[model samples]
Target: MIFGNPGITYAATVEVEAESAILVDAETGKILFEKEADLTLPPASMTKMMTEYLVLEAIEEGEISWDTTTQISDYPYSISADPSFSGVGLTQNQDYTVRELYEAMAINSDNATTIALAELIAGSEGAFVKMMNKKAAELGLPDYQFVNSTGLSNSNLGENYPEGTEPNANNLLSARSAALLAYHLVNDYPEALEITSITTTEFDGQQIRNWNWMLPNMPGYLADYGYEGMDGLKTGWTDLAGYCFTGTAERDGQRFISVVMKTNSEEARFQETRKLLDYGFKQFEQKELFPAGYQIEGESEVPVAKGKEGTVEIEAAEDLTTPVKNGQEDMYEVKYNISKEHLDKDGNLTAPIKKGEKIGTVELVYNGEDNYKNLVTGKTQKTAVDLVTTSAVEKSNWFMLMVGGVGNFFSDIFTSAMDMVKGWF
Candidate 1:
């Protein structure tokens, strides 16, 4: 049976200053707010989050180790020598450990170090770009295109653009896509935060600071933008991409991931992100709309055919809990879907149903105006719980089954005869 609640208030809305922006619950990937979130734009340095994910995955899979070292190729060496790009100077054919390069890339947004790590892992940057695109598809990112490891336009790489890519190409992602990438990075390899959270770390005896000023421990002038509960995330900018950031923070057992793209200035990215995160933390609360074993009133039972009992009761197999907007409890409703495979032709469950037997599922649907899609799957966020039988229903004995069959046969015959007589009249 279908049931619904009445009266839904519009979800509160907040304005953010950016071309594209999104906020999501880090744990559930449920989008809390979005504006032009699907508009594809250059991600700049935020592209490295994908690189970071692949590196951590390689390490976890035993393909490489933190101590693994690779020599600097001439391509990366030339890029490192240019001060215009973010990099640490590298000597030709000199060795550097994965740990060192990874820290520089994550903390300082070092383009050359990022490319070097990509080459080390995939034997070449071109191969690494392939891995990035493949992994994005695997992760269900809605919109993305990876042309280089550093998020730089291939024009910046000059003659060294990765093979099979356009020289004018730059990495692109929608805000939703960027948030999804960050979601997987943090959840899959949380250890990455250890390096990204560092405000400043010495690399080759030179101090390099993280680009994300929202981190809690910024020193000097950057301290002005510090935000509590903020941690390691990537920041980005280019002539084409404007300023962008993928930021994540945790407080009071809640974590939010935010992305702001094409903001006007270096500080605007963080400021816009602050708006997104604040809206999430201040306006929503963890709510259990329904508890486990919950059953809808007047619609909790399913008929059982040829069983000792006439019907079987069903209830939710697990709890339905998620972040809900404050004072918007009535905006949500539950829907039950019975499994056709478990029901007979007459819509009755077969005999001998076991207790807690898998039968159907109940899903939560949002009726408010600000309903949003999942960050990863790009589908409407409908959380579902399994429905199972509350108790077993034993099959009737042979005598009872025969009696029921006889009753059904006589009833059908009587109905047909009545219809025939009416037709003759």
Candidate 2:
């Protein structure tokens, strides 16, 4: 597919801790914008989000409970605080509720809490890491790895895992992977936002400030564009991962995800995240081109040989929506082709069709101008339709039967028999 779109680039702000970025709409999975979203980079504390995911999964499945408590072990990192402003004064025997640990893990970015939870969940951080990798595979995030639950820089601990001959980074992730992890966490678990969005909270009656300064302190990220429905996410930083933040916002039932990684400084990460989010919020508007369960245009209706009703309805499997910069709304042109080989001799649609099953495709031809066409693919979207056979029993009124097969039950019985004897023929 050829996309005749205007050219656009984010190279202007290309510098510092940011190695790559990607902007996508959560509601639509539409890639409104992106820049090297797939490039893998050190994730730092951002890896905790995946840990959050596993923990939540465990809790929801009754493997653990909110009230369930675990003992904090004396891991090297969990025990030693730089005497800096850190949460978790974790001692060897101290116990914490699963909910409390989750808060510590997400709200305060407590690496120690993460390691503890990971260790308890799988009996050891190493075994838990296997869980993390398994979960990543389940979620389809390929460019991520968790050697340890705590996302400490890899350069410090040399490779101790397999024979890769590389350093043993406690955890590593990409901008896209981070966003995906946070996306599922935020949307799937409302409790996560209830924790991460809080500026401050008490655990054992001590106030622990959220590491993600954007929540209450950073003015750079406090955009009044009505926040575009901004929601709570996490922030990350390290000598390796640099300054990174994953942000999400929703508006009018639409959600957008933006990932800014490797920013030079803490402030720079927020600034770049704001810039990327602004570009996304400004450049694209998601509009539905079609609706689900709606009849497919230019399709055939099934003919009934010995049934009460004559025909049934068929439609596209799912709704279709496209994201495009403003004024480019009308730029998408749909080109359709009919496949007679897949249809019966008559113009009526045949049965055995599933929802989202493909009857045909719609090729979106983009109006190439500016840089729009150059950046994204031209084919706008694909369309699926179901093939269902409908008929009515005995109808006294011919016109009414034409409308709904006698508008009665005799045909319904026939349909039941049809299903039963479907394989008979």
Q: All predictions: root-mean-square deviation over Cα? A: 2.4, 9.8
TM-score per model over all chains: 0.93, 0.72
| Model 2 lDDT at residue 25 | 67
Model 2 error, position 378 (Å): 15
| Model 2 C-alpha lDDT per residue in residues 1-425, reported as the tens digit of each score | 22344343323322323678777666545555566777788888778888888888898898988899888765634333535426566665667888888887788787667777887788876688788888887777757877766676544433323123236444667776777777677767767766776767887677776765555442343422224355667788877678888877666766677788888787787777777777766667777655554443554354432234455444444555667666565555444444555467665334434334454544344553523311122223332333322232332254644656554476788888899899687
Worst 10 residues of 2 by lDDT: 370-379
Clashing residue pairs for model 1: none
Report the C-alpha displacement of residue 64, candidate 2, in angstroms.
0.3
Model 2, TM vs. native: 0.72
* Model 1 worst lDDT window (10 residues): 1-10
lDDT against the true structure, each candidate: 0.90, 0.63
